[model samples]
Structures are given as C-alpha cells and as structure tokens.
Target chain A: MANVFHQRLDELDELLVDMARRVGEAIEHASAALLAIDTEAAAAIVAADEDLNALQFRVDDRIVELMTRYEPVATDLRFILAAVRISVDLERMGDLAKHVAKSVLLRAPAPAIPDSLREDFAGMGQAAVRISEKLVRVLAERDQMEATQLGLDDDVLDALQQRVHDQIPDLGYGPQVAVDAALLARFFERFGDHAVRISHQVVYLVTGDVHLDRS
Target chain B: MANVFHQRLDELDELLVDMARRVGEAIEHASAALLAIDTEAAAAIVAADEDLNALQFRVDDRIVELMTRYEPVATDLRFILAAVRISVDLERMGDLAKHVAKSVLLRAPAPAIPDSLREDFAGMGQAAVRISEKLVRVLAERDQMEATQLGLDDDVLDALQQRVHDQIPDLGYGPQVAVDAALLARFFERFGDHAVRISHQVVYLVTGDVHLDRS
Candidate 1:
C-alpha cells in the first residue's frame, strides 16, 4: 500500500513539472510573437493555454482522489495541501502567459511595444523564461536551494519592470501605446511572481516552513 | 461525528464571510484614498492588509487540521476543498486593494488618477464593493442565484474598464499618468475577477458543476 501511495505521489509530481515546462514554452512563444508581430504564433499560444488549464483540473481531481483514498495525515497531508496550492499558482502563470499572447494578437500588424522599449521587453521575456525553466527543475527535484534562488530570479523580472517604467517617459509612444506596454510588462512581471509563489509552496512542502511573501 | 464536522464547517464559513467583509472594506478605503488623494487613508489600507493575510493563514491552518481530524470524504471533502479555494481568492482580493493603496501612496499629494477618468474609477470601485457584498451573502447562505449574479456585476466593471480605455486618448495626460490609470483600472478589474472566481467555487460547492470560465 505504501509503495502504491509513493507511486501516485511521483505521478502527481510529473504532471506538475509537465505544467511548468509548458508554461515556459508559452512565455517564450508569446515573447517571440510579440517581437516578430506574428499573429499566428500568438493565436496558437492562446489556444494552447486551454491544455494547461485542463492539466490543472486533472491534477486537482487526482489530488482529491488521493486524499479520499489515502486519508494522509501529518507530513503527507501537508504535502497534498501544498500540491493543490502549487497547482493554483501554476495555472495562474499559464493565464498570465495567455494575457501576453492576447496582447500580441491585439497588435498583430503593429508591434505592441515601440522600438525604443523593445530591448527592455525582450529582457523581461528572457527573465520570465529563465525563471520558469528554474521552476520546472525545482518542482521536479524539490531542491530547496533552487527554490530559494527562484526568488532572486524574480528580482530580475522586477528590475526589468522598473526599467520599462523608467523608459516609458521617453519611449515617444502615444498614451494608448504607453498603456499597452505598461500592461504587457506587468503581465510578465506577474508571471514571474507566480513562479516564485510555486517555489515557495515547494519549500514549504519540503521544510514545513511557510514563507508567504505578501507581494 | 457528523454533527461535529458540520459545526466545524459552519465555523469555516463564518471565517470566510468575515474575510469577504474585510476585503470589501479594503476596496472601499482604497477607492476613497484614490479619489480623495488622502495619503493617510492609503497608508492605513496598506497596513490593514496584513490582517487579511493573517486571517487567510489562520483559515488555511484550520482547514488542514479539519481534514486531518475528520478524514472527510465525498461531499464533506469537496466542501473543504472549496473552502480553501475561496480563502485564496478572498486573500488575493485584499492584495489587489493594497496595490491600489500603494498606487495612491506613490503619487501622494497628486492624484493617481486625473479628473477626466475619476468618475470611471468611482464606478469601478462601487461595482467592486457591491460584488464583494454579494459575495459575503453568497458565502454565508450558499446562494447559487446570488453567485450567478456576481458574473454580471463583474461585467459592469469590465465595461467601466473599457470606458477608461476609450477616454484615455483624449485625457491630455502624459504617458506616465495614462499608464498609471490603466494599471489601476486593471487592478480593480482583476479584483472583480477574483470575486467572480470565488462565486464560481461557491456554485461548484452547491451544485457540483465546475464553471472554470477561462477569462
């Protein structure tokens, strides 16, 4: 019975890691579409988000089944609770990626960002992608060190957001463009935050320490 | 055993309703600070958010304890899961309010929003508050009808967001103000979205139908 339970837990981890990887791909594709003004890639990213959402539902249902079947207590119970929370954060990260893709779709023929701000957005996208890659490994390995490092990676995204704000005044774009760019930057920044949040849940699962950063 | 479990469930519902009420107050205070440009009120709202976070932690801890103690299955387990999800949404609504308060603080002595878009924001705030109030009733009474109404209330917020976008071009404000106003509007719209999410969870709890609503 214990072996079967451990096997089920392993399967759950695999599903979550799969979700993390797809979220990274979504961010990368959305970023590419934004830079190239490719509406097709953006539309594909939007459609792919449903798969992430569906995976989250499957994770959640499996979790409920595990709880009902195992009646896990103490550390096992804590792990299950954290799994549900982590899935929520991962699902939200996918939604943020979809928001970025939709921004690309909205300005298909025209770039959503001005050329002056293009480099900053590229940097933002790269930061988000790197953080998500780290997230996939962290979820799969449950490495506390990597989980701690995810917070630092999120700082890079925050700095990029500040850079976008600093450059907005001089970007020479109209108010409409400025607003769109700011929102786009915010969506990426939020994506990084959710990644950090998932890592925090992992840390809690591993160490029983709840560091709920109120961001 | 069933009686005690039902009692604990009732207690959990009260805590969630309490959270809903406090979140409504936070949004109201944040909105007032934005319109009045009152830095003190904004500061108060930011500080008070910690209390909401604390309440969420307390609720979460109790949920884990309840699950462990009762090992609830079937409907009882589903109810517990929904409680945790609702607490998450309510906690996030409080954070959104804090974001609004911080925006007010960042532009203290100068209104974060220009006079031209003030009424749209006012309408947004009122819509958020009404939705929150309905959320409190829906949680306390498990009213699926009121829960369904929340999606419609959120539409009012979406329309106001559109109005802000429509008016931004001619507002004569610089790019910075336009971005600020736009992000602020997005923040409120997200707050409404979270409310709708909580309502959806309530509907699922009452009817066992999952309306994920990929917005």
Candidate 2:
C-alpha cells in the first residue's frame, strides 16, 4: 500500500492539476472579457478565484501536516517545501488573473484596451494562457527542457510588456485609459513571472539545483 | 551549547529586522526621489535593495537548516515556517521599493509623479514608510495591537490608491504620465500588503492561529 504521506502528495498533485485547469479557464475568460468588456465573464473569473485560494489553503495545510508527522528529510522534505512554494505561486497567479478581471469590472461595458492597442493585449493575454499551460505540463512532467522554454517564453512576455509601454505614446488615451493599459500589461507580465517560478520549482524537483534563473 | 537551533532563529530575526529597516529606508529615498526627481537618491535606493535580498537569502537558508537538522515540531517548527513566509514578504517589499526607485531611474532627472499628483505621491510614500516601521515593531515585539494597526494602515493606502483613480480624469495627463501614476500608486499599495502579511505572520506566531485577515 502507498504510505499515507505519499498518498497525500499524490492527492496534492491532483489538486494542483485541478487548480491549474481552473486558472487556465480563468485567464481565458479574463482575456475574453478584456476584448469584449464582458462584465459577467469578468465577474465569473473573480468569483472562480476563491476556489483556487481554497485549494491553496488545503495544500498548505497538508504539507505542514506531512512535515510534522513524517519529518521526511532530504528529498522528501524538499518535495514538500517545493509544494508549499508552488502552491503560493499558483495562488498568486490566480490573483493576477483576477486583477485582469477586476480591470474589466472597473471599466464595465467599455473595453480596457483601445482598438489600436487591442493586438498588443491579445498577444499578451494569449502569451499568459500559453505560459500557464506549459507550466502545468512542466510541473507534471518535470521536463527540464520545457522548463527552459518557459524562461524563453517569459522573455516574449517581457518584450510584449515593453512594447505596450513603447506604444503608449502613440495610442494617446486619457489618464484612466492609460492607467488601465499600464496595469493590464503588468498583470499579464506577472502571470508569466508566476509561470516561470513554477518552472523553476519543477526544475528543482527534478534536478538538485533550483538555480535555473540564468537561462 | 546555547542550542544552535534557537540561536539560528535569533540570527534570522535580527537579519529580518535589519532587512525591514533597509526596505523602509529604500522606500523613503524612493519617495523623496519621486518628489524631487533626485536621480542620486533614486540610484542609491536601487543600489541598497540588493542588501535586502541578500539578507532574505540568509534568513531562508537558516530556516531550512534548522528545520532539517533539528526536526522541530509544533511551536518551534511553526516559528520556523512563519519565519520563512515572513522572510519572503520582507524580500518582496524590498523589491517593491526597488520598483519605485526604478520608476524614478527610468524617468530620471524628471519626476515619476507629475506635478499635479506630487501631493498624492507624497502621501502614499510617507504612508509606506510609516507602515514598514510599524511592521518591523510588530515582528520584533509580536505586538498583536501593532499588527492589527497594519490592517488599518493598509486601508488608508487603499483609499489613497482609489483616490488616484478618482483624481485621474481631473489631473489630465498623457499616457506615459498616467501609467506612471497608476504604477506608482500600486507600488505603494503593495508595500502595505507585505506589511500586513508580516503582521499576520507575527500574529500567527503568537496566537497559534493565522486568522488575522478578518481582523
């Protein structure tokens, strides 16, 4: 029989996959809301985030419980520690998606991106979705090569964020519109950051070193 | 033997307190630099933040060492866990301070805050400093009352952040200026979040319950 501790970790793995699925759907809705300014989709994304947070709490509790009960050292302990950090990162990514949704809600009935900059936002939102999808795969497979690809993907998102700022002057919106673009750009950029962090953690789990930042 | 484990924790506490101090100073300089557009102060703030990050690394290493070597359970273990989370929060607060400073550098020799929003930035920056000071006290003193005040202080920051939005239309800046204000206001607000998280961890350390969010 699988030990209770290993069973708990397996349970956590299932929950993490579920959490990632929810986050993917949340960001997709958030992106759609950005394009169409659908307040209902925005609101639904916001409401759906609580489920992610609940999963985070459950994951955290089980990790701490396992640590206390089993006191697993070395590899097992490191795995648990990685779980704690990954859960935090996943929760944070959920919040970032909600931030995008909140941006939509804040400007209800009006699209957050100007028509001229719509492509920029579209690219950003899609990059976020793609990065998270790859991140979930990396988490499950511990694919070091795919993990490296996440770093490369992060660079793409960063360039897109830089492009948003560079194009801001040409877009020529008022203060509120500018604020929305700046914040939305950042929310998208941070989604990539969380994905990269999860990739880093996965690389750590597979290899001994978590120092994948150099790529 | 002075129980090297507790000694390690004590060293971590001292390092964290020092890190908080450094972050407080970094934000203060960042704020002053914002108002004056003082490139030198902004540069100094950016340079100093690396120290905070280093201290965070030290604190984190020590916690894992303690956890692994001593195999502490219950209260001792909980303290180490909280320490790890608190360390992350403090390091992130440092990064927020650096973000503010970088905003200054990116717009160097020119204030990141527009003339119209100077007063708003001043209020936000000062509040960030005040919150960090209180946060350090809560961490050191484990003063629950002090910890609770951070939530109230955070409310003040939230209001200031909201006020920026309300004032945006009247302020009437170009896109770049509006982005600056929105991002800067957010940077200040997130500093409060780190403070509140630290306070919550401190409260959790003391009360054996991490439920300070509702309070």
Pick by DockQ: which candidate is best? Answer: 1
In candidate 2, the residue pairs with backbone N, CA or C atoms under 3 Å apart (3 or more residues apart, or in different chains) clash, namely none
Model 2 has fnat of: 0.58
C-alpha lDDT of residue B177 in model 1: 94
lDDT of 1 at B80: 82
Any runs in candidate 1 off by more than 4 Å, and if so which?
none
Off by over 4 Å in 2: A210-215, B212-215
Lowest lDDT block of 10, candidate 2 chain B: B206-215
Q: Ten consecutive residues with minimal summed lDDT in candidate 1 chain A?
A: A206-215
TM-score of chain B of each: 0.97, 0.94
Per-prediction tally of clashes:
0, 0
lDDT of 2 at B126: 79
Instruction: Score residue A42 of candidate 1 by CA lDDT.
Output: 92
Superposing all C-alpha atoms, what RMSD in Å does each candidate have to the true structure? 1.1, 2.2
- Kindly list the per-residue Cα lDDT of model 2 for residues A1-215, writing each as its tens digit: 23887887778777777777788788878998989989988999999888888887787678778777876767777777667667766887888899999988887777778898788888888888888788777877778888888788788889999998888877767767777888899988888887887788778788778473311
